[model samples]
Target: MTETEVLAVAGQQAIWACLMVGGPLLGLLLAVGVVVAILQALTQVQEAALAFVPKMVVLGLALMFGGPMAMSVLRTFTEDIFAQMVSVGGLR
Candidate 1:
């Protein structure tokens, strides 16, 4: 592969790893935010904590439960990059 191809593959892997790590937490946060917004609208009592607290809780829970998966994704990405580097080095 050319230098540009190697760079492109690395970039794509980085993006994929990021999405894999963050997608679940972001999705949960979005859902919680929407629910909080609707509830606040219905009750007409807007407290910042109402929104902030749930998101914080969800974020914490997500990280706790998803930490291993996230780590795995990062580890796999790192390994892949290293393997690619080895292959590229052999080309030199």
Candidate 2:
């Protein structure tokens, strides 16, 4: 493929990789926040920070669990881009 086509493909792949890596954790955090908010509303707790801790915990755990996979995905993308650049003589 031409340089432009290769770069476009790489850009798309990077975006897809980010989505794949982050989508599930973000979705889980959203679900938890919504559920917690509904429960707080029903109970009339109305604590502004009530959802914060749980969301933080859940997001932290998600990151911890998914860190390796996310790193691998990012590293692969970086390596691919570098390889393409080298192939195109963009890098010495």
Candidate 3:
């Protein structure tokens, strides 16, 4: 493949990997936000901390739980990129 083609593929893979790695955390936080919003509306709780704390808690939990898997995926992508870079003759 041409240089441009290889770079394009690498870029696409990087984006995909990022989405895949972050998608779960993003989705979880979104769901939590929606639920928290609804509860606040029902209870008439106007405290900003109410909306913020749960997200922080969830984010901590997600990273605690998902950190290893995310790291593995990122490592794989990085390794693949480096390996390809070497195969391509090392940065011209």
Per-prediction TM-score? 0.93, 0.90, 0.93
Q: Flag the better candidate by TM-score, 2 or 3.
A: 3
Clashes of 2: 0
How good is model 1 by TM-score? 0.93
Assess each prediction's global lDDT (C-alpha) against the native.
0.94, 0.89, 0.92
**Ranking of all predicted structures according to TM-score, beginning with the best and ending with the worst:** 1, 3, 2
- Among all windows of 10 consecutive residues in model 1, the one with the lowest summed lDDT is 83-92
lDDT of 3 by residue, 10-72 (tens): 999899899989999999999999999999999999899999999999999999999999999
Model 3 clash pairs?
none
lDDT per residue for candidate 1 within 1-92, as digits (tens), equals 98689989999999999999989889999999999999999999889999999999999999999999999999999999998898888755
Query: For model 2, which pairs clash?
Result: none
Scored against the true structure, residue 78 in model 1 reaches a CA lDDT of: 100
lDDT tens per residue, model 2, 1-92? 78898889888988989898989898999999999989998999988789798999999999998989999988998898888888877654
